[model samples]
Target: MAFNSAPKQFGTILLGVAGLGAFVLNLPAAAGRVTLFIGQILQALAPPWYGRNFARQLVEIGFYSLPVVGMTAIFTGMVLALQSYTGFARFSAESAIPNVVVVSITRELGPVLAGLIVAGRVGSAMAAEIGTMRVTEQIDALWALSTNPFRYLVLPRVLAAILVLPLLVLVADIIGVTGGYFIATARLGFHPGTYIQNTWSFLEAQDVISGLVKAAVFGFIIALMGCYHGYKSRGGAAGVGTAATYAVVSASILILISNYLVTELFFAQ
Candidate 1:
């Protein structure tokens, strides 16, 4: 029995070794893909820019995403105010509600939530559009016509996202703070003037700037993941659908991870 078990144990060990080897090999492959994707972006920045396409994408990503971002921000701010009051009232610190709402929105929630909403809305759309082009051999047709697909399709969207997301986040910050203000004054029986003063006095320029910076970085990550997955898509329709899902998931995860890193950079003690 011991001799027979020895062969089975050796087989399991061999399988584990092979799995580890494959995992190690995938690291470099992923790195190379990232390198190539970035290279394409850099090259797209050269002459023969697609101004019209860039404008279109800007409207699509920034303007079109506003309603969703706005609603999310408004409700988030309201809830924050209500919750802050509930917790602070226990300690007789209800006066801190305004400060908490403004600081929280500007420092963290505004940019993060806006990025997530856009990642879900625009990122998936980008992946589906480009992946479909890839699957249908339209990308190959562009190559045949001497038109670089990255320059035509990828650059506009990426640049638009990088440029527009900060503005979106700024708007979200304002709307969120306003929502908090309304809920505090109207629903929670707080004095409007005092709440506004507390929020204004407690808020700093650094908070807003940090959030905008985070928005820009998040935007870049969102577009990068979408384009990278879509550009490399294979199989067929099923593959395009999978690429869309991957784009949203990857962008959302990167947004959260990078959010912590950026916060540490700005606020770490």
Candidate 2:
């Protein structure tokens, strides 16, 4: 009996190995699909666009998202100020708190945190909504009506996210600085005027611009991942949930990766 079963076990092992190889090979095809999808989105950028949809998307992505972003910024700044005080105090460099706060906020924390928050919030929403539309055949209905789904659905959200994220990052930068200032003056007994002066002096335009650039790239990645996953989703409600998860996870990972690349490009030694 054992000798007879040997062949069957070997066949099963071979089948498993083949399946794993197929899965590994499919990664390149999946990447190609994503690249093509991105190309289509960019192609839709030109020509007469849906102004109303774009406006709505802008408000949805930016204005509605402001409160959460602001709250996050303020708290982060406050905490950073306190933390900087602890470290700087050890070296008798407490006077550098304002400089540290401003540079850190404008250069890294503000954009990175805002991108992550939006990825979790807005990116997931985009995936869920689009996936639902896809599963329900709403996208097909649009195609039947001679309407371009990419133009009507994807473009507006993508453009809105790309445009507004920079603005959001800028606001986060301001709010973060303000929060740091408040914490320093009210809790740390810092002189407000001196703190403000130090922040102003140390902050360079390049730092702020770099953060905004990072925001734009992050926005593109977020929207693209969400739309790509949603548009390609199958199955049913389970697919929608999967798409949302993929969107958020992919967007966040890409954001961090892009952040480092952009930082290197901007400030490489």
Candidate 3:
């Protein structure tokens, strides 16, 4: 009997390990599926289904997100300027402050940081709201009514996120530069005219464009993760909570990872 039980336990452990490995392996495939879903939705572009919802989502995801993004940009810019000035001062290159601030904000910090903030704020909210709907059978009811959930629900938020994030990042880039300008000119005693000149002189069209592109991608990731996790939510309240947590965490991680990849692609010679 003992020997028989030992074999059973060993089999159980082996099965568990295999399951874990399969889950790990399938993560990339799951991500690809989600991407494909998004692509299909984008390609379809059915105006009657996704348009009105998209406008509502724009107000929810974009208009409501401004204050947090603005505040974050301002403080980030101020701190970055201070830190950069200190570092550059050691090398007698403090005059590079404006250029560094502009390049850093436009090329990387503005979009990446803004996306992270939205992931935490908007991503979790979306997941929670949609997950609750799923748990309460509202999503099923919609399906019963012959409404395509993806067309009515997911596509709108996704489109809104993609459209709004670029605008938010643009505002962030400008505000961040202005914050850095204030610190550099006021606290550091740099000339305002020269700082402005240095900022514009070093920043190119590509830098701004690249950051906007990244913002759009990050926005899609944020909304996609939220909708995917939320729509597939199971169990009950606990499951809804878990989905929301995973949505935010996964979106944030993907944003950071993708940011590096995009930077490499854009800046690599």
- A best-first ranking of the candidates according to their lDDT comes to 2, 1, 3
The lDDT per prediction is 0.94, 0.95, 0.92
Model 3: per-residue Cα lDDT over 72-134, one tens digit each: 999889998999999999999999989889999998999999999999999999999999999
Give the true-structure RMSD of model 1.
Answer: 2.6
Candidate 1: stretches off by over 4 Å: 1-25
Worst lDDT 10-window in candidate 3: 41-50
lDDT of 1 at 64: 99
Best by lDDT: 2
Q: Which pairs of residues have clashing backbones in candidate 1?
A: none
- The number of clashing residue pairs in model 1 is 0
TM-score of each: 0.92, 0.91, 0.89
| lDDT for residue 240 in candidate 1, whole number 0-100 | 96
- Which tens-of-lDDT digit does each residue in 1-269 have in candidate 1? 99999999999999999999998999899879888889978987888988999999999999999999999999999999999999999999999999999999999999999999999999999999999999999999999998898999999989999999999999999999999999999989999889888999999999999999999999998899888889889999999999999999989999999999999999999
